[model samples]
Target: MSLKKLETLSTKLLLKNPYWEYKLDNYTLPGGQTGEYHYVHTPGAAMVIPVHDDGTLVLVKQFRYLWKKESMEFACGGVKDGDFLSTAKNELSEEAQLAARDLRQVGEFNPFNGATDEICRVYLATGLSKATRERDASEEFEVLRMSVAEFEDLAGKGTIWDGMTLAGWMLARRSVSALLKEKRL
Candidate 1:
């Protein structure tokens, strides 16, 4: 059976912030059922998997307020002015203090489609060089460099729990493995 789509009747803004907007959407199902769905409206995001010249991955460890613990993740940020590459570059510099000479789009995914309209574009960044980091006033991170195997182990053990990071890694895992294999030779 083909699934019917929800027809949105109206959308109410519940809250607004500089980052995202919370909205309530009233919709009607094709079967004559109506319901209200609340979700976050976002401009989307971009994440970068930075691989160093020696094939180590660049990541960041930061304290997540909601989780009340430190979380390791790839450099990522919400899209600004609807530009994915610009956001990726800026986030990579700000969060990891590294700039990539070769930045290529890997893939995109909806991190939490059921709860938010956020599509995060994942990029594979290489040809890295150092840059001065300028983090936001509310942000603090410790840059880390680890091998792909190490990252995978941590991710498998539940140490790396950020959905965006996991999605980004999954998107770039094959490319990363190839790069590591090439570098080892």
Candidate 2:
């Protein structure tokens, strides 16, 4: 089945953030009903699955204002104008202070599916090298390196609860395992 778009109505800001805006859309359902949807108009973002050569994953713990607590998550940030890869690299360096020799796309996700129109491109950062820390002003992250088994134990025991972090770990572990089995790791 496919979803077909009917009509779109957008509101453009003439002042302050001229580029940032909202778009309201209308769609025709399969049963011939019209539905309206509102989405926050904005550019997408990126997240990283930082993994070491030994198949260990790197994650960060930081305070999330919305959740009012620290969350353990993969390195993530917004993609600036015309610089997706650089945004990923900058986010990794800022959050974890590590550069990867092999940075490749793992997957992508819609962080806010209901109202926002932002797609977070997920990547796997491997072969980490020497890099100095330069975290964002609003960010304070504590880094951790753990094996897949350790991560499984933590997740199973309810010790690690961050969804994004868990997803990154799971995907990276699967990829690493497949690569190792095929002599590609």
In model 2, where do residues sit more than 4 Å from their true spots? 1-4, 12-36, 156-158, 167-173, 180-185
Q: Write the per-residue lDDT of candidate 2 for residues 38-156, one digit (tens) a residue.
A: 66766677788777767777878888899798777778877768567888898888888899998998777676588677777788887898587676687788988887677788788
- Candidate 1: segments with Cα more than 4 A from true spot: none
- Among these predictions, the greatest TM-score belongs to 1
- Alpha-carbon error at 142 in model 1, in Å? 0.4
Taking all chains together, each candidate's TM-score versus the true structure is 0.96, 0.79
lDDT of 1 by residue, 1-185 (tens): 98889999999999999999999999999998999999999999999999988888999999999989999999999996999999999999999999999999999999888999999999999999998867899999999999888999999999999988998998999998888788772
True-vs-predicted CA distance for residue 149, candidate 1, Å: 0.8
Error of 2 at 130 (Å): 2.5
TM-score of model number 2: 0.79
What is the number of backbone collisions in each predicted candidate, taken in the order shown?
A: 0, 0
Where is the poorest 10-residue window by lDDT in model 2?
A: 10-19
